[model samples]
Target: MELKGKIAVITGASSGIGALTAHLLGQRGAIPVLLARSEDKLRAAAERITGEYGLYRCDVSNSGEVEETIAKIIAKYGRIDILLNNAGFGRFADFIEMPVEEFGEMMNVNYMGVVRCTKAAVPHMLERGRGQIVNVASMAGKIGTARSAAYTASKHAVLGFTNALRQELRYSGITVSAVNPGPIETEFFKLADPSGDYIKNVGGFMMTPQYVAERIVKLIEKDKEELDLPRLAAAGIRLYGLFPRLADKLTYKMLNRK
Candidate 1:
C-alpha cells in the first residue's frame, strides 16, 4: 500500500508517463527501477529519482530479455515490491491497411510484454507472499476505436490478463490492477501517427503525464483493481459498451468527420 521503502519496477521509463511515474514514486520514498530500450534515457531518469533507483536497458517485447533483466533485479535488490507494466507502442491504421509486422510489434510490446514481465515477476512475488502489479492499459481496452484495431485488441488482452491474474492471486498477498488512461499527452500519439492531427483533435482535452502519474501512485496505495482517468472519457466508454450501435454512430460522426 504505502510506497515508502518499496522497490518499484517501471517499464517504459525512457519518457512520458513512465518517466513521470518513476520520479513521483521516488518522491514518495519508493526505490524505483527504470527499464526501457534507451540506455541513455534510463540513466537520465534514474539520476532524477533522488532516491535509490537503477536503470536497466530492456526491450520488453523479448521474453528472454525480460526474464534476464528481472533476474538481475532480484539478485541485486533481493525482492521487488511493485511492477508497473507501462512499456507499449501504437500504430494507427485501418486493419486492412495496417502491416502485419506493425500489429505483431504492437502485440509484442503491449500485450506479450506484459505477459513476459508478469511471468518473471509473479513467481518472485508469490514466493515472498506479497507484491503489486500494475498494467497500463487504455480506455481503448474497454471499447473499440477507429484506426486502432490492433492497439485496442492488445489493451483488451491486457485488461483480461490483469483480471485473471488478480483472481488467481486473490489468496496471495500479491495484488494485480490495471490503469486505463483515456488520452494523456504523450509520445505515443506521435509514434502512432506522424501527422499528429488525429490525436491532437481527439485528445484536445488530454491530461498531463504528471496527472496520470499521480493517479497511478494513488492506485498503488489503494490497491484498486482498475483506475480510469478523465471521468468524461471513462463515462463515454461505459456508454459505448451499453449501446454499441449508437456509440458507433456517434463515434463515426465525431472522429470520422475530418
Candidate 2:
C-alpha cells in the first residue's frame, strides 16, 4: 500500500513509540495527525516532524475529546486514511494489592480508548471505503503474567476488540490490525514498574521503541492482520496457547520476573 499523502492519526503521539512512529510515517510521505493529553509535548513533537502533520490535544479516555478531535481532523484533512490506537499505559501490581481506581483507569485508557478512537474513525473510513486501523496491544494480552493482573486484563480487552472489529470491517475496504510487543526501552517502565525489577530481569530481551515503530509502519503499509514483535517472545505466546499446563510449568520463573 502506498503511504504517500495518507492522513494517519496516531494517539499517544507525544512520546515513545507513538512519537517515533509519527516521525517515521512523515518520512514515508504520510501526513501524521498527532494526539495526546500533553499540549506542550505535542507542540514539541510537531515541530520535530520533517513534513506535513496535525496536532491535537486528545485524551482517549474521554469520549468527548476523542470524538471532537476526530471530527476536527476530518474537517481539516478531508478524511482519515489511517488510525493508530496506541494511547495506553500499564501499572504492574498484584490483583489484591492494586488500587481499584487504577484498574478502572487502565481499562478506560488501554481498552476503551481503542474503542473510542476506532468508533469515531470508522464512519469516516466507511464513507471513503478505504482506511487502516492499528491497535497497539501487548504480550500480556496473550499470556497472563504475575503482578500484572489489571494491566493484562486491559490488554486482553484490546486484543478481543481488535479481533472482533477486524472481522466486522472485513469487506469495508478498511483493514484493522493489532501489534503485540513485549517490553520496550521507554518511559513506560517509569509508571508500569517503578522499582524497575521487571526491566532489570529482562533487560537483554527488551526492544527499543524505534525497532517496534518500524514494524508498526510496515504493518500499516502492508495492512497485516496482526504483528507480534521480537520473534522469541512471540514464540513463547504460541507455545503457551498450544500447551497451557506445560507452558505454566516451564515459564513459572520467567512469568514471575515482573
Question: How much is 209 displaced in model 1, in angstroms?
Answer: 0.5
TM-score for each candidate, following the candidate numbering = 0.95, 0.98
Error in Å for residue 200 of model 1: 2.9
> Which candidate wins on lDDT?
2
Clashing pairs in 2: none
lDDT of 2: 0.93
State each model's CA lDDT, in order.
Answer: 0.89, 0.93
Candidate 2 at 122: error in angstroms?
Answer: 0.1
Best prediction by TM-score: 2
